[model samples]
Target: FWDILEQPPGSYPEIEKQYFGTHVSLTTDIAGDYLIKLTVSDGYSVVSDTVTVSFYYENVAPSVETISAVYAIQDQTVPLDGSGSYDPNGDVMTYQWFFVSKPKGSNAVIDDPLAEVTSFYVDVPGIYAVSLAVSDGELEGKPYNPFYVKAFSLLGAHTKLLVNEDIEPQLLPYKERFVVDKTLTDDEVAKEYVLGRYTIEAVGKDVTISNISATDHLNLIKPYFRGWSENEIVVVKKGESLTFELVSPPTNGKLTDLSFSFAWSLNGVGDFSMQERFSAGYDFTSR
Candidate 1:
């Protein structure tokens, strides 16, 4: 005789005396534990034994979906969306977001690390790599590739003038201008100018200017003297000045003429008109 002692919730094979046999085979349609008992009798004596079987299904991890890249201005809050992630088992899932890498000196952090959607402020101007993973309470799934976020600054130029002679060099009044060709974020537009400075110093006999800006915001700024490349840039920050030296010191008892011309561009795009054309004549008779 064969009897089912315990079984999962579902219809299972039936055992009856009319269908009894020395050996019986049973199969279940559901995935769970099953217990069965078998007994044999010769007239007065009987022997019984029990067996247990179990079925298991593997759990699938959740799938993550998001954009590959994002672009924005510096100091702006970039949003991250991972609401499209789903679990194959229809299990409740949790979200986890983290930064794989970021620019040097950047302290950007996600607003809500465990939220399906979150955002972070770009502290520095550079590329930031971000990653996302989802948990179905059992298994965790990560995207095949991480995403990138790029932050850039608007174009800006600063012009400085230097007058050098027998006396200590003097830095004349200078001008600064920032150009906006593309749309700007609310924070950027409100501030009108980003926080940072670029400096260009003119040195040596050829009067070549050198880019001395500490940051990488300004890709290139070329200086031209009378529509020619001095092979240099003329830029300086507030409270700072550029120094220019003539090929030869002014001859005594003579008037020397000095002038400079240059054009600048931010991130190597859109040439800006020469901000200043400085020409001056000084008498070197005293020297």
Candidate 2:
């Protein structure tokens, strides 16, 4: 016959005797289809229920495979690529990519439209890293796959204006006109700033003059200076001179001595023109 089982056999909360049913140990001796009952009582009423227990192992989650920069360039387009492993249990699959700045192996990735994309651009320049994450909707995989990105440096530059011109001093005698030859070199012709000097001597008693001087007109090509970005003009002189010297500088690249020169007339009399057009092939070491 089976023994009767009772909870709180001592009938008190902290009694020295057993307050519940005795511990039972089953050692494969119990047969199939045995009916068992459980009861709990606080020395007044009783209540009962049944429960089942089970255990098993679960499958591991999928992980990230690889993240890399597929393409990169300085002035052109760039692309990044990513790949990973996913669980085969028909679980939800997701892919994410990121660029972490500090604390290596950080999961905090930059959220972007290309995060899930296999390949994308670096567009700009700088050092960077790419990380890939693939999840199987369950336990996340171990370390995520990361790739390094290298960038090339930019080389050439494009500028708009250049200065090339020279200035020479020529002293004239009283009542007589004379032309002074000035030589300019490549270095002088390529300068953006030039200092031109010319000497005028009064012929008749330091005559009171208005609009009496020589001028060297210069036409510059693709000439620009300071904030100005257009054709440049090198004006020699606009008015009179009395034993005076004129100094002028060019602001643009068009003033190369080889491509520019001057012709002059004092008091509307004798004329002095450039003996020969300046040559770009001239040596600049002497100047």
Candidate 3:
């Protein structure tokens, strides 16, 4: 503050301007919560205001509560229970089931998004780890894991065990009718084995027995097969007969160097024991 001023008559007036400081920019994280601040200023003074903002995330995990198991014969359709899952946030949820130890090329059974199955029919016999994973819009939950029942069948052995002229059996033609024998239903001799038709004579210790078939029925049949060599595991093209150790049953008696041979003659009555041929040196345990 200096003095009272006097102006000249033809005066050029000076203008004073007000200026604010810098601009304010805001940002947020995946949750979309934001803190905002405003700057107000003249060239000589500055001030600020505080504010907040909200944002949302779209992806979320799904929730799984329970699963149900349905039983079925091999190759028959079975229903699965997926009623244990829900989207709490009201988002849509997806479902999937899997066989963890499935054989090669069987993954297509459950890979379809449209394979709406409450239970999947199990045709092969084995232990299977079943799993279901679900997802909602914002998140996906952990998969529920469980075990489902399964069984495998011989290539061709069924209810009607077909015997050759020499009382030997062949398993190739009647595979579809064979059901896995959990109990010793058909033959005490082959109580724990899978069903297969063979044209071999019951050579060493096992006796030749009568055969029967189950028609349009859900029945478990105890079955037996002649020991197979590595070469006989599957037909080979220009390959030698295999001589691998027989995968012994849980019983003590085991067959080794088991090999398979085709019937050379349709006329001569083949040895019934030769139908399911086993090596001479291997021990076979009875269940």
lDDT of each: 0.54, 0.34, 0.37
Q: Which lDDT tens digits does candidate 2 get at residues 1-287? A: 12223322332122122334355422222222233344566669877654332222355677555643322233333334444455645467676665644233323234452354444344444545666565666665534435655433333211111122222221111122222223343444433332322233222222222223223334222221232112322222333232222222443323332222222232232232122111111111112
Which pairs clash inside model 1?
200-235
Q: Write the per-residue lDDT of candidate 3 for residues 94-134, one digit (tens) a residue.
A: 77666667644443265353332454545565445566666
The runs of at least 3 residues in candidate 2 whose Cα sits more than 4 Å from the true structure, single-residue gaps closed, are 1-57, 67-71, 88-90, 102-116, 142-145, 156-287
Total residue pair clashes for candidate 2: 17
In the range 1-287, model 1's lDDT, one tens digit per residue, is: 78788988875755445246766667666678778788888899999898886766678999999764744556667878998888887889999999999999999999999999999988888888999999988899999988787665422222323333322212221332322222322222221112212233332112223322121122222112221235446443334444433222212223332223233332232243232222222211112
What is candidate 1's local distance difference test score? Answer: 0.54
Q: CA lDDT of 144 in candidate 2? A: 42
TM-score for each of the candidates: 0.39, 0.28, 0.30
Give the number of the best model, judged by TM-score: 1
Off by over 4 Å in 3: 1-60, 69-71, 103-108, 114-119, 152-287
Q: Give the TM-score of candidate 2.
A: 0.28
